[model samples]
Target: MMWLAVGAGAALGAWLRWGLSVWLNPVSSWLPLGTWLANLGGGYLMGLAMGAVLAHPHWSAETRLFIMTGFLGGLTTFSTFSSEVLTHLLKGNWVAATGMILLHVCGSVMLTLLGFWQAQQWWGRA
Candidate 1:
């Protein structure tokens, strides 16, 4: 049952990720905007989901797994990010590679915190 839930979530997440790439990747050639947005958004969504799960402990583990491990695992394209970084390095564009790394890492951390805090505020009052 857990596996099924995760698989279903992953399928949907993967499709969504692909759509983001198709739609937004063309906007920039130097950096994959779609993948970047995916990571940032995934981080925020992850934090929100975790916050909700923590606030409502009665929820099943499957629900958490489906959202975080399954959906997020597929939505955030770390592999694609790595490849893009490698591509930059191979082309001797160290600045671009490092910039991308910093942006994704910092942005992810910040957005995750923001999302978690926002979710907490939404549920903490109760």
Candidate 2:
């Protein structure tokens, strides 16, 4: 049952990730804007989920696994992000590579915190 839940969540996540990429990634752009956005958004969502789960301890571990491990695991593409950074390095675009690395790391964490804090506020009142 757990496996089925995870698999289903992963399938949905992958489709959503693909759709966002197709919708946002422009052919002419050098940077992968779609992937960046996906990761950042995923971070925020994961943080929100974390906050919610913490507030509502009644949520099962399987439920958390389905959303975080299964869904977010598929939604956020760190492997692709690494490959893009590697490609940039190989092409001698050190500045771009560095910037992307910093932005993805820092921006994602900040957004995640923002989402967590916002959700925490709602949970606090509840």
Candidate 3:
């Protein structure tokens, strides 16, 4: 059952990632905005889910696995991020590479913190 849940969550996450990429592909020809959005969104969701899970200890291990492992594992694309950065570096676009690195790392962390804070507020936690 746990495996089933994880598989289902992974499938859903992968579909969502693909849909977002297809939707954003035409909008930006040079940049990988789709991957950025997916990673940031996945990070935010992971943070939110983690907050809720921490507050509510009754959440099953399977639930955590399905979310943190299955869903986020499929949604976030670290390899693609690395590849994009490497491409920029190889092309001598130091500024772009640094910018992307800072943006992805800092933006994702900030969004995750925001999600965690929102979850805490929703749960009436200080």
- Considering every candidate listed, which one attains the maximal TM-score? 1
Residue-by-residue lDDT tens digits, candidate 1, 1-126: 999879988988888889998999899878789899999999999889878887898888788888888899889888898999999999999999999999888999899998889889988722
Report how far off residue 45 is in candidate 3 (Å): 0.8
Model 2 scores worst on lDDT over the 10 consecutive residues at 24-33
Cand. 3 Cα-lDDT: 0.84
lDDT, candidate 3, 1-126, per-residue tens: 899778878888888888888888568644688888998999899889878987888989898889988888789878888998899899998988898898788888898898898889887563
* Predicted candidate 2 versus true structure: per-residue lDDT over 21-121, tens digit per residue: 88887852566888888899999998898898888989887898899888987888888889989999999999989989998889899989988898899
lDDT of 1 at 107: 92
Q: What is the lDDT of residue 98 in candidate 2?
A: 94
List clash counts for every candidate, in order: 0, 0, 0
In model 3, state the lDDT of residue 93: 88
Worst 10 residues of 1 by lDDT: 117-126
**What TM-score goes with each of the models?**
0.95, 0.92, 0.89
List candidate 2 stretches off by more than 4 Å: none
Descending-lDDT candidate ranking: 1, 2, 3
